[model samples]
Every structure is written in C-alpha cells, then in structure tokens.
Target: MTRLVVVGAGITGLAAAFEWRRRRPDDEIVVVEAGDRIGGKLDRIRLAGTWYDTGPEALLGRVPEAVGLVEALGWGDRLVAPATTQASVVLPEGRFPLPAGTVLGVPASADGLDGVLTPTGVARVRAEVELPPLSLPDGDVAVGGLLRERLGDEVVDRLVEPLLGGVYAGRADELSLAATMPALAAQVRGAGSVLEAAAAARDAGSRSRFDADGPVFVTVDAGIGALPAALVEAARAEVRLRTPAHGLRRTAGGFEVSVGTAAAPEVLTADAVILTAPATKAARLLGEVAPRAVDPLRGIPYASMAVVAIAFPVQDVPAGSGLLVPPVTGRLVKGVTVSSAKWPHLAGGEALLVRSSVGRFGDESQLQRSDEELAADVVADVAELLGLSRPEPLETRVARWGGGLPQYLVGHPERVAAARAAVGEVPGLAVAGAAYEGVGVPACIRDAHRAVDALA
Candidate 1:
C-alpha cells in the first residue's frame, strides 16, 4: 500500500485528497491541517437564522472543472446563479450604472461614460481612435500603467482601479496584466487602441464556444462553505486537525514530514506529499527538502481583507448585485454585495443581507481596528452610498481574513514556473493553491487536480 500525505486541509488540499481516493482507493491518504477546522478561507457564518459565506460567496460557473466538481459531489441541483448580472459603481453623487461592453470596467466604447467620466476624461477616451498605434513593452506591465496610457488617469482611477482591485484585492497599477488579465494583455500587445482591442475580443468571445449569455458565476444555495464541507466528508481520509507540519526532509524511500514539537515530534513518512497551504506556510515546510523553493515562495506577497455581513429589511437594501467603490471615490469600503438581490435563496426572508468588503494590499490598517469599529465604518459607507440616513441594520457580523488574497506581481508566471521546477527536483512532491494559477474556487480545484496528477 502507498502512503500519501497532503498538508493543509483547505479546499485545494481536500480536493486533491478526494481526487486521489477516487482514482486510487487503495492508497492510504492523510490530510494534516494546522487549523482546528477545515476550509482555510471558505467559512459559513449563520446570522439571523440564515447562512452567509464569510469568504468567497460565488464561483466562476464558466469554468468546467469548477462546475464538474460540484456536480460530481451531488450539488448540481442545488446550484444557484446570480439573479441579475447588473452592477453599479460608487461615485461622488451616488451609485451609477456600470457601463455595458466593459472588461473589468475598461469601457470598450465611449458612449456610456456620461456620468462616470468628466468631459476631459471622455475626450481622452475618444482620442484613442485617432491616437497612433499603441506601443506596448516586450514583457508584462502593470494593468493600470497600460490602461492609463491609453484611457488617461481619470478613467483608470475612477473605473479600472476598483474593478480590478475588487478581484485581487490589490491596486491595478501594481497588479501584473499577464497574470491578472491575460486576454486583455494579449489584446493590448499590438492593438492600435485599448477600447478597439477590448471590443474585438468581446465580439470574438461572443461568437465563440463561450456562452456569453450564461451565468457568469454560481454558488450552492446553502452557501459556498458547503462545497468544502461536503468535500471533506466525502473524501473520508485520515484528517488530523490542529496538527501542523513542522518540517520536511527527503528519505531513501520517500519523504518524512515532521509535526508537533521537536522534543516529542511525530514524523510521518510518505511516498508522496502535496502541499496546499499558502506560500509562506509552504515555504517554511519545504526548508529541509526543497530549500531552493523557499526564496521564491517567500517572494510571493499576501493581502488581508475583512467582510462585514449586515442584514436589513428588503426595502433598505440597494438594488442590483452590489456596487464597487472606485479608489478615486475616497471611500473606506471597497465594495458591497446586495446578497438578497443577487440570489433568490437569500431573499424571501424577513431580513435582507448585504456584505461590505474592506482593506486591500497596501491598505490593511483598517483591519487593525476592532470588529465593531470596522462594522460601524462599513455601515456608514453603506448608508451614505444608498442615501439612507443613519439606517440601522437588523443584524451585523464581521469576518476578518488576514493574508487572504495573494498578489501576483510582475514576472509571476516565470516565478511560478521556476518554483515548480525547484520543487519538482524533489521526487514525489507538489504544491497547490490559489497562490499559483488563480484565486477563485474553480481555479483552486483545477490546481488541486493538477497537483494530484503530478504525484502520479
């Protein structure tokens, strides 16, 4: 019998374990986690007799791997799509409708920039057509830098910043285009204009196999937290919670993983090991066997953020999925998701739920405040955005996720490849998580599957 040890019991680790058992049932699998509970970031919080997700609430349904895993887990029927794709952006006056035909708030056409862009800003966008063929650098560039060159600073600040920030929890100017938005990056490579390239790409995608009209995202009606819970339950592997992996070393036969204190440490030898923890944790564990991988892993930075879920009467909640706050707005709250309007399952109750997300890459000071302080600040932003005066909520809850999202800096793709090569030098070792390929649920699942295959 073969022994497989999967470190870190997050979705990625659990998914890898589950896949291993499904394919090789005879193999003994053990999942070790430092935390008492599983689901690293996917947590379910029950408030006012209803369930809400503290981490990611939805999955990119367009990703086949994500959908396939959910259906395979018998959650196909319970899958729910966003009731509406419509979203708005917060401005000085109030919330304004996000323009159509925009990719991550980069408008493909200048027609919808009325309320969002100033007269001078609109002129800068209109000049894109007349502007000479854009010259892009040979390699990866910051998303904001590229867009600002074409669309002007105002558009990048008012539109592109928030949309991209909402996804990676990092400023657009600092995020790498190749790692964050490859499609747009490709378009920007040789295109004469950014808007023209975006328009062409959108048109091509609409006419391709991609379902442009399909639901962009989906989630389990109960909550996304259920997915990981079901995964852990179904995997039925030997799960050791509150037991962290302390050390790793190569052995003649395989590898030895150390846990607990050095004085009375327990070591488990395995033919294969899959590390699915964050970059920092994974780096520390690889110190003995794959020392070279540690530097690159440590180079990867993480951003912390907090989510405040508040419930109110249906009438008090704003319409639409939610509104994103452009950095130019000078707002503390980054974004807000009107849960009730987005999902019917979250509606029909006496109270409607709204979630406010705050804190980002370089702006984590807000997280230093107490939960009450954070919740109060977010509530004030919500009230002001919705034009409600001192509107009290029926209930409120705050969930803090320190080091939640990973920042994919420039040269990320090359860095990831080099890290993989360094770890691959050590036989029967692999790493998986959102830090590598993607941050969404589907990306994590797909990454896990690849890690499992690597062990084979």
Candidate 2:
C-alpha cells in the first residue's frame, strides 16, 4: 500500500486526506495536525449555553465544493442557508445598506443606493456603466487598482475595503483580484462590463447554486465544524492531532515528512506529500525541494484576525440579520453577524447568538488585543449599529486566528503558477487551500480535490 503523509489538518489538509481515501480505499494515509484537535481554522465553541462557530461561520454561495462534500459525507440533511438579503455597510459618515446586485464592491444594482454613496459618489458609480472596464489578460492586478479604474476611490474606501477585509482580511490595494475573485475579473476581461455580467449571472439559474432559493449558502445543522468532524469520522480515525511537522525532505520514491516541534523530529515517509498549512509554513517545509515555489508561496500574505461571540436572550436582541462595518467607518471590527438569525438552530430556544469579526490586513493592535478588550469593542460596535443600548452579553467567547486570510497580492496568479511549476520539480507533491485559488469553504474543497487528483 502506498503511504501518503499530509501536513496540517486544516480543512484543505483534511479534505486532501478524505479525497485520498476515496480514490484508494486500501492506501495508507496519515494526517498530522499541529493542533490538539482536528479542524485547524474551523472551530466550534459553546458560550452561554449555545454553540457558536468561532472560525469561518458562513461562506458565500459562489462556491459549491463545500456543500457537495457535506452531502457526500452522508450529511445531506445538515444544510442551512441565509434567509434575508439585509446587510448594513458602514461608511465614514455612518453605516448604511449594501446595495443589492453590486458585483463585488461596484454597484450592480444601484438604482437607489444614495444612502451608501453621496450624490457625487452616485455619479461616480453611474459613470462605471458609461465607461469601459480596464481589461487585462488572464493575470493578477490589485483589487484596488481595478476598483479605482472602474469605480472610484470613494467606493473602494467606503465599501470594498471593509467588505473584502471582513472576508479576506486583506487591503484592497494589495489583494489580488484574479486569485480572490476570478469570475468578477473574467467579466471585465470578457464582456468589458460588470453590469452586463451581473445581469447575465442574475439571469442564470446556476447563480444560486449555493443558496436556499436557487442554492443559498448553507452550513451543517450541527455547525460548520460538523463538516470537518464528518470528514474525520469518514476517515475512520486516520488523523493524528497535535503533531506539527518540523521539516520535509524529497526522496526518490516519496518524501520524508519530519513531525514534532522538538529536536530530532519523528520522520515519516510517504509516496506523496500534500502540504495545506498556511502559505509561510508550507513554503518553509518545502523550501529545499522546491525553492522557486517557496518565495511566491511565502509571498502570499495573511492577516491575524479574532472573533468575539456573544449570547443574548432571543426576544431581547435587536431585530436585524447582520451588519457589515467598512474600514472607512474608522472602526476596529469588520462585521457582525446575527448568528441566531442566519442559522437559528445554532442557538434556539430562549437565547440568541451574535458573532463579531474584528481585525484584518494591517490592524495589528485590534487583532492582538486581549479577549476582554476585543469583546468590549465588538459589543460596542454591534450595539451602536443595531440600535441596542446597554447590551450586555450573557457569555463572552473569543477566538484569535494568527495570520488568518491570505493576502493575494497583484501578482498572485503568477505566484501560484510559479509555485505549481516549482512543485512540478518534485513528483508526488501538491498544494491545497484557500491561499492557492479560493478563500471560501467551497473553494478550499475544490482545491483539495485538484490536489488529490494530482497525487493519484
């Protein structure tokens, strides 16, 4: 039997292991995770007698792999989706509604979005329909650059910054449009009109594949962690937690993966190596075997982020789905989701759940703040935005992800291509994770599938 050693038990890593088992049921595979438990980035915690998804609570409907994987794991009944389209986008002046039909940050459905944009701002956005898109070939360009050319600085600062930062923890100017949102970029490259693409996409049935209506974004009834737990369960205990890789070396037939943080690592050899750790960590372990891949792989930037989850009496909570804080608001938090509303089952009965995400890109102080400080900041933001006065949490829970979402810079696709080219230098090696192509859970699953095929 072939031995396949996987480094990191993140969603991508675990997905890789699952895919391997699926391809060759008799093949021996070992998934070494540094954390004491499985699910590296996805975590579930209970606070105030309710469950809260501490990490990656919800993903957009644009990606499909996440949902498919869940169903494949025999968890078909564990799906849930967002019901309403309500979102409060914070502006420098105040938080306002995120206009519908807006593709990315550009106003795709801005017939009456004057509340978010000024008269001049509205005119600037309207101009996008008249002017042609700044088309580029299939290559990476700064998201800021694209927005600046097509839209304007105001829209980018006021909306795009906060929205993308909330999800990717990246600066619009440095993040890669091609890597983060390739379909939107393709609209510009192909049709030369975002509006047209938006119209066409909205007209298509496949657009809602992830949502409840067409196919809204859905999480497992048990929580996002259920997907990972199901994956590990399906593997039948082939995963090893709390085992970090010290280093890795390429061999003739396979690669020898060094595990353990202590001196003299416990080396395990395998016919194939799938590294799904953060960009920096993956580059470090695979540097010697794939030096050319290491530089670009490491260049993929990530931001440290923290989330504060709070529980409240269901009836006492403010009545809204969620609110998004744009960086232009001069606030520390990126957004707040009324978890109780998005997926009611997570906190049913008499209590409500709320999750606030803070710190992204360059906000070191906010991301590094103490648990108490974070909870206070998040609470304050949520209370003010939701019109709740003197809102106190029944229980406070905090989770910090060091170097969270990767910053796919202007040349990310090139870097990813270069990384793949370098990986080609070593046989039986592959990369899988949000850093490579996609950031949402579905994209990660899709990336994992690609890696498994490569290994096979």
Candidate 3:
C-alpha cells in the first residue's frame, strides 16, 4: 500500500487527508500537527455554560466544498441557516443597514447606499458610469486603489473597508482585486465601468445558488468549531498532534519527513507528502526539496485578531445580526455579531450572547493587552455601537488568534501559481492552505481536493 504524509491538521490538511482516503481507501495516511489540538483556527470553547465557536462561526453555504463535505459525512441534517443575515454598519452619525445589491460593499447601484455613504459619496458612485470607460491592466490591481479612483475615498472607507476588514483583517488599499473578488474582477475587465461590472456580478450571483431567498451562510448546530474533529474522525487517518514536522527532503523511494523536537527527532517515510502548514512553516519545510516555492510562500503576510465572546443576562439587544464598524470610526472593536440574534440555536436562552472582533492587518497593539483588558474594551465598544445600557456581562471569554489571517496583497494570484507550479515539478509533493487560495472553509476544502487531484 502507498503511504501519504499530510503535514498540519488544520481544515486544509485534514480535508486533504480525507480526500486521499476517499480516493485511495487502502492507502496509509498520516497527519502531523504542531498544535496540541487537531483544529487549527476552527475551534470551540465553553462560554457562559455553553459551547460557542471561537474562530469562524459559519461557512459560505453557496460553496459546495464545505456543505458537500457535511453531506458526505452524514451530517447534512445538522446544517443550520442563520435566522437573519441582515447586518448594519455603525457610522459616526448613526447605524444604517448594510447596503444590498453589492459584491463585498461595492455597490451594484447607489440606490441603497444613501445613508451609508455621504451624499457627496453617493453622487460620486452614481457618476461612475458617466466617467470614462474603465479598464483593468493585464495584471492585478489593488481593490481600494481602483475603487477610490473610479468612485471616491468615501465609498472605499465607508463601504468596502469595513467589509474587507471583517473578512481579511487587511486594508483594501493593500488587498488584490483579482484574488479577493475574482468575480467582480473578471467583469471589470470587459464591462464599461466599475458600477456596470458590479451590477453584472451581482446579477450573476442572484441567478446562482446565492440568490436572496436561499441561505448564503450556514453552520452546524453544534458550532462550526466542531467540524475539525468530525473531519478527523471521518478521515480515520493516524493523527500525530503536537508533532511538528521540522524538515522535509526527497528520498529514493519517495520522501522522508523529520518531525518532533530537535533533541528527539523521528522520521516518517511516505510515497507522497502534502505540506499544509502555514506559509512560513511550509516555506521552512520545503527549503530543501522545493526551494523555489519557499520565497513566494514566505512573502505572504498574516494578520492577528481576537474574538471576545460575552454573555449578558438579558434578551434585549440590537435588532440586526451584527454591526460592522469601520476604522474611520476609530472604534476598538472592528465588528460585533449578536450571536443570539443570528443563530436560531443560540436563541431562547436567558443570556444574550455577543461576539466582538478586534485588530486588523498592521494593528496588534490592541491584541497585546491582557485578556481582561481586551474583553473589557470590546464590551464597552459593543455597548456603544449597539446603544446598550452598559449591561454587565454574566460571563466573558477571549480567544486570540495570532497570525491567523493571510493577506492576499496585489499579485497574490501569480505568487500562489508560481509556488504551486514549483511544487508540482516534484513528483510526490504538493501544498494546500488558506495562503494559496481563499481563506474561508470552502476554499480550503476546494484546494485540498485540487492537491489530491494533482497527485492523482
């Protein structure tokens, strides 16, 4: 039987292992993770006497990879759609509904963005079509730069920045348009203007599974953090937790992986190896066998953030699912999700749960504060944003993720392609993770299948 070694047990690595088992059931699969737990960022913690997701709380249901995986594992019945996906953006003036008919805050039409954007800003957006026909270069362009030129600073700051921050925790001016919003980017190239491109993209999205009537995001009743354990069990591979793979080198038969502490190292021989560690760790491991892949991998930067879950002993809270606060507001918390309002499973309890996210790409000073200080600050920010009466939290929990998000800066697509092409040159080597493609669960799963298919 052939042996496959999968380094890193995050969603991508575990998904890779699962895909391999599905294709080659008789093959031996080994998964090695440096962390004490199996799940990387996907994890759950007990807060206010209930299990709550500390990492990503939902999956994009429109994407088949994650939802399909749930179905394949016989957990289809456990899927849950949010009670209300409607969210508001908190501005210095007041809170307003997140404008609809937009792809990641880029308005398809300026109809719904009246209050969200200043009157001047709205006029600028309406004038976009009147501006000279817009065209993208042969290569990628920064998302913020393109929008600011065509629309204005107000649109980018008020609309796009908060949404992109919530997803990547990175600035729009630095993010890649092609990598972040490929659908809109594709339309931008051929469409007459950015507004026309956005309208086309939004229309196309409505025709797909992401239509308004259907659920765009989904989660399990048990919590999204539970997915990693379920995936590990389904794969049924030998998982070596807290076992770091320090070195990887090509061997005559296949490959040899040196893992564990330097003082007590052990080697595992496999016919194939899948490196799913973070970009930096992957770069270090592939230094010898896939030197060309190392630079591109290391070039990818990461952002750190923290999730503070708070339970207040009252049901009366904000009406919407959450509120997105742009950096322009100078709020300590970037966003706040009213857990009890969003998820049906989390409702009907005496306590109202709220999860607040803090920090961005280049800002970690907020994260450096002690857990108590950070949680307190977030709680205060949430109260102000939601117009709550400074309700004391019955219980509070803080979960910090350092270097958790990978930034897809300009030319990210080309960098990833180069890294993958270099790795593919080696017969039995492949790499897959959030750094290579989209950062969401579905993207990671999709890339895992791609890696497995490449090996096949």
Best by TM-score: 3
List CA RMSD, all candidates. 1.8, 2.4, 1.3
Which candidate model has the greater TM-score, 1 or 3?
A: 3
**Tens-digit per-residue lDDT, 388-430, candidate 1:** 5436888889988889899998877777787898898988999
lDDT of 3 at 218: 91
Give the candidate number with the greatest lDDT: 3
**Poorest stretch of ten by lDDT in candidate 3:** 205-214
Q: What TM-score does model 2 achieve against the real structure?
A: 0.92
Against the unseen true structure, what C-alpha lDDT does each candidate score?
0.85, 0.76, 0.90
The TM-score values for the models, in the order shown, are 0.95, 0.92, 0.98
**Candidate 2 lDDT (Cα, whole model)?**
0.76
Arranged by lDDT with the best first, the candidates are 3, 1, 2
Ranking by TM-score: 3, 1, 2
Candidate 2 residue pairs that clash: 176-408, 208-215, 210-215, 210-216, 210-217, 211-215, 211-216, 211-217, 212-216, 301-407
What is the Cα root-mean-square deviation between model 3 and the actual structure?
1.3
Error of 3 at 262 (Å): 1.2
Cα deviation of 109, candidate 1, in Å: 2.4
- Put down candidate 3 lDDT per residue, 1-456, tens digits, no spaces: 999999999999999998899999999999999989988889898777777999999999886889898888889999999999999998888899998878999998779888998999989989998988986677999999999999999889988999999999999999999999988997998999988999898878777664357489999988888888888888889999889999898989999999988888999999999998889999999889989988999889999999999998765775589999999998999999999999999988878889999989999887999999998888888876777764788899998889999999999999898899889999988999999889999999999999999995
